[model samples]
Each structure stands twice: as C-alpha cells, then as structure tokens.
Target: MSPLDDEAWEAWSPHELGQRLREATLPWYVAGGWALDIWHGKQTREHEDLEFVVIRNDADHFRAILHELEFFTVKDGTTEYLPPAANLPSDVWQLWGGDMRHGCWRVDMMMEPGTPDLWIYKRDRAIQMARSDAVRVSETGIPYLAPINVMLFKAKHCRKKDQIDFNFLRPRLSLEEKEQLTTWLNELHPGHEWIKKLPIS
Candidate 1:
C-alpha cells in the first residue's frame, strides 16, 4: 500500500525542478523520457512525472534538501514513508515524492549505485563509466543522462514511447555512441529487435 493517498499533483517542468535544486552539491540528473527530450532540445511528448537519479550514497543528501515534500520508498509495488535518514533496503531503488501542502505527487527519485566519480550500471556492475561521461548539462545548467545511456535504459522496457525516443535519436547518435549502444544492447539483450533497427553499420 502507498503511504500517501492518491491526490492530484502538479507535474513540474525540468527547469522548475532544476531551479529548486540549484543549491544542491550532490550529483543529480534528469532521467527517463525527459532526458531524451533534453537531448532533442525540445519536448516531444507530455511527461506525466519528472524523474531524477542520484547516487545511492547521496540519497540522504537528496532527501535533506527536499525535506518539505513527502517521500515514500517503493518496493514490490508497495510504498512506505521514508523516515529521516532512512537507509533504503538493498532491493529497493525507487522513491516517490509528493507535495504535502497541495496533496499532489511531484517527483520520482531513482537511486543508482556508484561512487562520486563513477556510474556503475546496477544490473551489471561491470558496466561502468566516469560520471562526467555519463551525464550532460543543458545550456541552462539542467543535467540529464546522455542519450545513448538513456536509450540503453529504455531498451529494457521498449515501450511505444521508448521506441519513439529511439527513432528520434537514432539518426543523431555519434559513431561512438552507436557502437557502444549496439555492443551493450547485444550483450545485455541479445537479439533485441532494436538491434536490427538501429542504423549502425
């Protein structure tokens, strides 16, 4: 059961959320479909919610700044309020945030494993990259996941929107990004339909 009751919450734009966390020192980056939109330099579709990813080690730091909002730890489709400085269980990596004052859902906070300088793919620790290479910042200073990395994550789901995202970004992928994505997809999801669809030659 979710700790927070269902309520209407206003979805915040990436810029608005970025401004709210402008003072944060810990690493956080826009993720999900929004990241793809950022890479495209335009909003291709409406987003139901905003997602931001923070290193697991910095979850507490992230909670500290967003203390005013209500947070719930999600596991196996159940949710419980996340108390101050609560240590998230090993299997759990998602947090849902809602505005208490307005009774509305706000953000989906995703936790990932990595050090301050590296990003280790949770599914396969062997897959890693320097944090600098894993993220990019918009001209306005909003940090977002690099496109190929976002596509890699989306490949796991391959929903309609995910396919749209891939179709939109495929032509824009650099040679290196295309090669890396193809290699990772082949290793992680052998025979994924996108493998044949990707424009990599």
Candidate 2:
C-alpha cells in the first residue's frame, strides 16, 4: 500500500495543496500529464505524480513543505537533493508514495519561467476536483491550471511526451482555441510533423 491514505490525498487535493503554498503564493504552474488533463478538461489517463512548475527562488520553501508532509530526503546529496531510488530527471524532485505510473503518490515539482508581467494578466483560473463533486480538501483544494499557459508550454517543448499530452488535451479545447493553438504551433515550428502525426483521440 502507498504511504498516502485517503486522508493524505485529502490534504494533497488540488485546492488544499494550492492553499498550503498560498502564503508564499509562489509563481507555480502545473505541467506534465496532469497539466494535460487541465488543458483537456478530462483526465486521459492516471498520473504517476503531481508535476508543478515553480520559480527557482521558491525551491527551498517547496522542499520544506514536502518534508513536513513526511517526504524524506531520498537523494539529499545529489545535485538538487533528488530521491535516488525514484530515478527522476535531473530537474525533478520526487516525493515518495505516489503510485506515479498511474498517477498515484509521487509528487514531482520543477521550476520554470513565468509569463511576462504584461501577459500574466490574461491567464485564467478555475477550480476542479479529483472527482466531480466540487469538493476539495481545503481552500486551495481544487486542481487548477492556466490553460493557455500550459498550451504555450507544450508548443515550445514539442517532445514526444509533450506531443502525447497535447494529443490527449486537444479534443477538449474549443474550436477557436484549437485553431489558435494550431496557428501558434505553426508559427513555433513551421511544418512540424507533430501537427499531422498526433492522434486526435
């Protein structure tokens, strides 16, 4: 069994989790498969961990909070205090117990650049639950994302994994937003095969 029980998830639920970091209200965003679900409006598959994009300045605070949640220093000596057994990428911090393959106990956090101040004004925010009851663990308990922000992120990365996430999220977008994304993609990588090869379903 995983270290996180039902109650633990309650604490980590999107809204509750977000609230925990609200004091700092660090510039964080969702990324990876979970972010794809936010962009698509539905979960295409289970996630292994909760991937977050944070500003580098907030890294220590983020680590401290995870420790409070019982996440030990699995890789304290490595570059960036990684959990060695978790085998994550150099940039990711892997917290124990999440069934990462199916999107269970692992929480992966990373740092990324934020939108410029002028563009930040255009971001959107919404509340969602792991299930559909509008229920959350705390004030910030709901899962949230900036759809356009995630979309732009996928566009720039364009790796196989990124394409897969975009594929899962694409069908959930409005026709206009889809068009805009397509236009953006074209501009980002003119005639890139990703536009034609991704499975819509």
Worst 10 residues of 2 by lDDT: 127-136
In model 2, the Cα lDDT at residue 76 comes to: 54
TM-score of every candidate: 0.93, 0.51
lDDT of each: 0.86, 0.47
Clash pairs detected, candidate 1: 9-104
Q: Which candidate is the best by lDDT?
A: 1
Displacement of residue 156 (Cα, Å) in model 1 is 1.1
Task: Tell me the spans in candidate 1 whose CA falls farther than 4 Å from its real position.
Answer: 5-9
Instruction: Write candidate 1's Cα lDDT for 1-201 as tens digits.
Output: 236554455768899889889999999999999998988899999887888999987888888888878788878878788776667777779988878777777888999999879988877889999999999999999999999898888999899989888998888888888889999999999999988876666
Q: Give the distance in Å from residue 95's predicted Cα in candidate 2 to where it truly belongs.
A: 9.4
* Candidate 2 lDDT (Cα, 0 to 1): 0.47
